[model samples]
Target: MTAAHCTFFGESNPETVQSMQGCMRKLKLMVPKLRVQKRVKELEFIQHVIEYIRDLELILSEDESYTPHSTQISPISPHLDSTYRP
Candidate 1:
């Protein structure tokens, strides 16, 4: 059997480039055999991991004692409250 070869056009060593090309060829040939359901599950797991990382980042960035100015309003006057009464 004739040996297969691939050419690389960069500063890479010939042996390393040849091995990488061979592995890429094998991966291309095998990709069509991968299941769609398995791919979806893998993507879902990746998405969940990304979301968990974002949530943790938000939690870590927040101050435990931080309070919003909106929640610090003074009590409304009783006369102002009666104006909107049904």
Candidate 2:
């Protein structure tokens, strides 16, 4: 049967069939590369978070002031008391 007659199975013409075949070819070409690209992106994101955490650790370790208000006190103290105070 002609492609036009095959429309009873699905609403597809000759041009639509050709387009679908092209899309399938493109998807076959891209799927593997897309997966690799996604993995690279995830690794980059993890690296960025690791670097950010490292920088944050350095910032927290170094004695610095982060006073937001007059009543605000430093969370980290050089001296640790025997009792834990909230």
Candidate 3:
């Protein structure tokens, strides 16, 4: 069956069944890469949380080894704004 939805450059150029199958195949191949990227982001977030907890533990223990850098800023935090000063 022809793909009625597949078109190019505002043209109604009908895609053959082969072309549609190829598109699906390409999308399937890309799925792994997308999944890997998502997993990496998840791992990074977990690691960040672990490190934060470790820092908090050190501070609570009064080890003086967990000094938070004043210049450090969280790029992932949405709570920060242009007018907001710490």
Best by TM-score: 2
In candidate 2, what residue range of length 10 has the lowest lDDT sum? 77-86
lDDT per residue for candidate 2 within 1-86, as digits (tens), equals 34343333474777877766565444333233332343445455445445544654555457366433558655643332211121
lDDT of 1 by residue, 14-63 (tens): 68676765754543333322212243354554454455445444543574
**How big is the positional error of residue 26 in model 2, measured in Å on the Cα after superposition?**
33
Which prediction has the highest lDDT against the true structure?
2
Please rank every candidate by lDDT, starting with the best.
2, 1, 3
Error of 3 at 39 (Å): 12
Clashing pairs in 1: none
lDDT of model 2 at position 20: 60
Off by over 4 Å in 2: 1-40, 64-86
lDDT of 3 by residue, 1-86 (tens): 23443433444334655565465454333333332243345455445445545544544367454345546553423322221221
Query: How accurate locally, in lDDT, is each candidate?
Result: 0.44, 0.45, 0.42
Return whichever of 2 and 3 wins on lDDT: 2
Against the hidden reference, what TM-scores do the models get? 0.28, 0.29, 0.27
Q: How do all the candidates rank in terms of TM-score, highest first?
A: 2, 1, 3
Point out the higher-scoring one by TM-score: 1 or 2: 2
Candidate 3: stretches off by over 4 Å: 1-40, 63-86
Which candidate would rank higher by lDDT, 1 or 3? Answer: 1
